[model samples]
Target: MTTYDYLIIGHGIAGATLAHELRRRGRTVLVLDTYQTDSASNVAAGLMNPVAGKRFALAWRADDFLTAAATFYRELEQRFGQQFFFETPILKLFSSVAEQNTLLARSADHPWQNFVEELAPSLPPAPGVRQDFGGVRIRRGGYLAVRELLVALAAEGLEQGWLRRETFDWNQLVVGPASASYAGDVHARRVVCCEGAAAVHNPYFDWLPLTPNQGEVIDVECSGLADTQVLNKGAYVLPLGAARFRVGATYRWPPFAEGTTEEARAELSQRLASMTDQPFVVLAQRAGVRPAVRDRKPLLGVHPATPVMSILNGFGSKGVMLAPLLAGHFADVLEGHAELWPEVNILRYHALYVAARKEGGFSS
Candidate 1:
C-alpha cells in the first residue's frame, strides 16, 4: 500500500530518464516494468549522429539537445559511478557528388557547423570501399550504454522502494481528476506512460498519429573493425567493444511484428557483406518497434481529457539524444515552472484530432 508522487510505467530510455529526473527532484517515484523482451532500449545501437545519414540534414535541435544530453549523461555517471556515455565521432561516407554538394551548402549556413569536420579530401576509403565523396566527421557524437544505465537506474529505484518488477495491467487503473490509483494500493498524484509503441493502446492518448515501425538488426563479431567510431557507408556498423559490432536496421511500417526473420537476417548480411570483405560471425539478431510519429518528432505532454495522465514516449530512433532534454522539460511542466514545447507537445495532436473528428475523420 505504498503511494508515490509519480508512477512511471516502463523502464525504457524515456521512463528511466523520467524516474531519474523525479528522484533527483526529491520526489517519490515508482516504476512498474517488465524488461528484456526485445525492448527498444536493449536492442538499440545507441548511436547519436548529428547529421541524418540519408539526406545529410541536421538532426532536430541538434545544438540544444546535443549539449544537454552530453551534460546529463556525464552528470549521471559522476553521480552513480557508472560510465554510460562515450564520446566518439561518426564517419559518414558520401554516396554521390550531389549529396556532397548538399553537405557543403549546409555546412556554410548550418548552426552545427562547428561539430562537422571537413574530411573528404585526405582520408582514403578503405579497401573494397567506393564513393563519390570521401566523407565528413561528426564531432562529439557517440553511443550511450543504455542497458547499463537502465540497470543502474533500476538498482537506485529498488533501493528507494520505487520499482516493481511486473507488467502493468490496464484494467487495474482508476483515474481521477487530480490523482490516479493503480491496483488499489499504488496511488500517485500523476502517472506518465513511457511504454514506447504500446502508447497507441492507451485509451486517453491513442488518437495521436503514431506511425510505429519495426526495425531489425544483426549482432556480429568482426575481427578488424575499430571499436572507437560508428561507421556509416550505407548501413550503420556500430562497434560494441572487443571486436563485437552491431549492424542493422530495416524500417517497416504497420503490420508490426517484433520477431526477427530469416529474410531480415539475409538482408542485413547482404548489407554488411557489402561493407567489408572481412569475415564476421553472426551472433544474434533482434527486432523491435520504434515509437515513431509521422512528423518525426517526439510526442510529449499531458493527456488532453484526463488531467491525471501524461506520456513521454515516441522518441523513435533518437531516444538517447532526445530523451534527456525532453525529460527535463517534462519535469519542468510537472513542477509548474514552464510550458511544454509546442512542436513536441501532445496538445497539437489533440487540436488536430478535434478538427478531424468534426470533419467525420476516424479518431479514437
Candidate 2:
C-alpha cells in the first residue's frame, strides 16, 4: 500500500494549484486526473480582467486576486522555465454613450483608479478593429496559456512521482475517522475532490447546486491585424501570437453534449463581426462545460459528515484568477493555520444535503 498526506482528484486549475500549494508546504500529495478533453480549464482563454461587463464594475476582491495571481504565476514560470503568463492590456470598446459614462464614473472612484486608464487620442487606431465610440484601456489584465501550464505542471508532478493519470472511482473511496483509503491501495489523511462538473454524480457532494454551463471558442488566423492586446465588446478576441487569435464564448444552460454546435459557431461569428471588419480564416472551434454554482461563489471546505473528505470546486468562469488565492487559503485551512471563508464554505449547504438524504434524493 502507498500512503500520502493528501489525495486530489482532477488536475484542472483548482486541483493543480492546490496540489502545488500543498507541496510547497512540504506535504506529501498525490494527484489523479483523467484529462477530460472538454474540461473548462483545458479550453478556457485564461483571461484575467479586474473590471468586467458593460457596467465597468470592479470584480469582487479584484486587487487582492490580481496581486496574488501575478506572484503565483511568476513563481511558477521561474520554477518550470516556461513562459505561460503575459501581462497584456484589454481594450474595452464602448458601444454606446452610456457605456462611456459608466467608464468615466468608475475611473474617478478610488478603487478603480489603479486598474482603469483612459487612452489618449495620440495612440494609433487598432488595426482591423472598429472604435466608433472610443475605448478604455484596462491595466493589470492578461491571459494565461492554461493548457500549456497544466501540461508543464503535470510533467513535473509525474517526474516527482506525485501525479498519476487515471480515472477516480468514488465507490472505492472509504472514509475512516482520521483518514481515507482509495482503490484499496492508496491511503491518505484527506481526499479533496476537484472534479468540476463530474461532482454532480458524486454521492457525498451530489447535493450541491453544480450547474454545468457549456461554452465555445473559435480559433482564427488573421493576416494583417496588428493589435496584440485583448479586445472586448460583446465578446473577447485574444491574440495567440503569429497572427492567430482566440474568440469566444457562449454560455448555455444544461449542456447536452461535449461537442461543438453550429449555433455556437454563428454566435461567436456574430460577436467577432461586431468587434472588427477584418477577414480571417477559421482554424478551429471548441467547447467545454464550466461548473457554476447557484450562489455564484466557489464551493470549498470539508464534508460535514466526513472530516477526512473535502472539496474545492465551482469557481465558474473566473477560475483562472480565483484558483491561486483560494487554493492558498484552502492550504492554510488544511494546515490548521486559518479557516474557510463563510461565503465559500460548503457547510452552508449542510441542511440542504441533510434534507435531500432524508427524502432519499441521494444515497449514502
Highest TM-score: which candidate?
2
In order of appearance, the predictions have TM-scores of 0.92, 0.96
Candidate 2's residue-wise lDDT over 6-49, tens digit each? 99999999999999999999999999999887899998999999
Give the Å error, residue 173, model 1: 0.9
Off by over 4 Å in 1: 121-132, 355-364
Model 1, poorest ten-residue lDDT window? 121-130
lDDT by residue for model 1 over 96-148, one digit each (tens)? 77777777766767776878866464355554333446678788788898888
Model 2 gets an lDDT of 0.88
* Deviation (Å) of 293 in candidate 2: 1.2
Lowest-sum lDDT 10-residue window in model 2: 115-124
